[model samples]
Target: MKAAIATSYGSPDVIHLAEVPMPTPKPTEILVRIHASAVNAADWRLRSANPWFVRLVFGPFKPRRPILGVVFAGEVVGTGVAATKYKKGDKLFGWTSLMKLGGHAEYVALPETGAFAPIPAAMSYTDAAAIPFGFGTAFSFLRKAQVAQGQRVLIYGASGAVGSAAVQLAKTMGAQVTGVCSTRNTELVRSLGADHVLDYTKDDILAKRDLYDVVFETVGKLPFKESLALVKQSGTIITGSEMPTQMLARLFAGKADKQVKVIGGTALSTAADMKHLAQLSAEQAILPVIDQVLPLERIVEAHARAESGRKVGNVVVEMG
Candidate 1:
């Protein structure tokens, strides 16, 4: 088996491919031969340990897991005796959790029941692999917001992975969706069901006061004050990106504005959420917006592309 591994975090150049031992499943696990996987901002973030705090969770000197990938679309090649949920040749897609990430490899072993579902018949392996992080995160935030019909929802960075998915999900919930992106992506965002498109370069989103019932800051840079001003009274702001200062502020702001709530963190993904995303894909309601596809050998390039922050949606890496 060939895998891209990182010993110490720094730049994308630190990741290199080498032959590694094939993984075998434990009694409660299944061995999946990966077909396609995705490179996300999280992948690069963890790889480089961008924020100094990540060093505490992963490692101070090196990464806890050498191979870094979160989403995988693959076929079950072998299963342990205790694994009853799936058998050989079952095609599935899902995300590997923080501690168990090894999706960058040609094969990975996951518990019989982790975050995965049968790929939708209408979707390809590349597309299914793209779902977990983007759609899962977006779905989680929207659910947290308790989005409802007729609610005006504003999505920042509406052309990226999570942002694109949020645009579609918000529309599915019958919200009047407004997407913020670069001028180049205005039409693309509109096609994803955003009722309005704001080019960040041209429009000043903060200037639009009290306009939305829910403001989703998918890009993570939206300031707390601007977000507070953008939302209607009692509205909620959900951020999926890392903003430690804002997170800490929200934690001790009981005496602060009680009318607005700011939330941030990675979503808790479940097999059920993957299944629901599959159903939406089967129905053509939400589609994976793939920016580029590369072979596993090109992982360094893939990581560079994802880190560039210009990809329309996801950058996929095919394994086999």
Candidate 2:
């Protein structure tokens, strides 16, 4: 099996294409022959361990997991003795669990009961691969925030993967969507169903007070205090990126917040979320915006693009 392996975490240059041993499924697992995978913020974040805290999971000296990918769309090539959920030739897509991340390869083995889901026949492998991260994250956050119809929802960094997904999903949920992105992506964000588009370069959206019922920072770049201010009284602010103070506050704040709640949270990559995304994709209700498709060999370039914070949507890597 050919895989992009990371021996030591650093720059994109650290990832090397190598011939690795083929993975065999455990008795409760299914072996998937990967057709395509997608590069996301998680991939690069794990690659470089940007925040020093990442070293705790990836390893201080070296990575615990060599292969680096979270989202994958593939076909089941074989199944283990006890794995009954899927059989040979079943097409599927899912994100590898936090501890079992190994999607950037020709093949991977995951438990039958894991996050994997059958890809809709109408969807391409590349599209299926693209949905798990951005779409899944957006779906989780929006649903958790209880986004409702007619409510004003603002999404910061609205042109990237998660942001783009957030835009369409928020609109589908009946919220009046406002998307914030660069000047170049105003039309792209608007096409995703944003009722209003704010170019961060020209518009100081933070100046607006109490504008949104739900304010979502998809890229995790907004200041926590500012995000809180953007939300209406007793409303919600959901952010993918967060600082320790924000995380600690949310942790102690318990399950519900009576006042304006700031959520620096994670999107659940459960099988249910994948199924929901599949149905949405099948109906063309929510589309996974694909920025580019590169071969596994060009993974370095792919990583560079994802790290550059300039791509309009998902960047897919097709298996050769």
Candidate 3:
């Protein structure tokens, strides 16, 4: 099996293509032949050991896992005797759990009960590879906040993977969506069903007198205080990306107001969530926006592209 190995945390140069042993499924697991994977913030963040806490959790000096990828789109090549959920030739796509990240390879073995669902026949592997992280995260958070129809919702960093998903999902829930992004992505966000698009470079979001029922900070770049000011009384604010300090601030801020709720934590996905996303994709209700596609051999370039901050949506790597 060929994989992109990251021996130590550092620049994208640290990742290299290498031949690794193929994974075999356990009695309760299934072996998948990966056709495509995606490069997301999780990959680069773990690779660089950013935020410093990644070092303590992953490893002090090096990464615990060498092949860093959380989502994959592939076909089941083999299944253990006890794994009755899927069989050979079944096409599935989903997350590999952060603890067992190994999607950036030719093959992977995971438990049959892991988060996975059948990919629609019309969808391509590259598209399926882009869904789990962005759409899954957005789906979890929006449902957590209970975004309902007729509510006003604002999404910051509306052009990125999670942000793009958030915009569309909010609209699907019938919320009046407002997306904030760079001047270049105004049209893109608008096309995703955002009722209003704010160009961060020129729009004065704070100047608006109207407050929203929900303010979602998808990129962690938006200031907590600013989000606090934007939400209406007793509204919810979903922070998709929050550092340790920001988390503490969120706690204090929530307590201080007593009415405004601040939600921040890891986004979890289940088999049911994957199934819903698959159905939405098949119906063209929530499309995964892709920026570019690269081969597995150019994993380094893929990492660079994902970290470049210029990609509009996802950076997919084909296992060819």
Highest-scoring model, TM-score = 3
lDDT of each: 0.89, 0.88, 0.92
**Candidates' RMSD to native:** 1.6, 2.5, 1.3
Put down candidate 1 lDDT per residue, 1-320, tens digits, no spaces.
98989888989999999899999899999999999999998889989997778789998989988999988999999999899999898999998776688999999999988989999876789888888889999998899899999999999999999999999999989999999999999999999889999999999787788889999989876766677788888899887785678777656644256388666777888999999988988999998899999998899999999999899989999986
Give candidate 2 misplaced runs (Cα > 4 Å).
245-258
Give one digit per residue, the lDDT tens place, for model 3 in 121-212. 89999999999999999999999999998999999999998999999999889999999999999999999999999998998999742389
The candidate, 1 or 2, that scores higher on TM-score is 1
Between the candidate structures 2 and 3, which one is better when assessed by lDDT? 3
Off by over 4 Å in 3: 251-255
Model 3 worst lDDT run, 10 consecutive residues? 249-258
Candidate 2's error at 177, in angstroms? 0.4
Per-residue CA lDDT of model 2 for 1-320, tens digit only, reads 99998899899999999999999999999999999999888889889987777899789988999899998999999999999998899999989776778899999999998886899999999989999988888888898889998999999999999999999999889999999999999999999899999988998887876789999988767766677667788898887767566666555643343377665555677898898888888889898899999999999999999999899899999998
What's the lDDT for candidate 2? 0.88
**What TM-score against the true fold does each predicted structure earn?**
0.96, 0.95, 0.97
Top-lDDT structure, candidate number:
3
Model 3 pairs in collision:
none
Model 1 spans with C-alpha error above 4 angstroms: 248-255
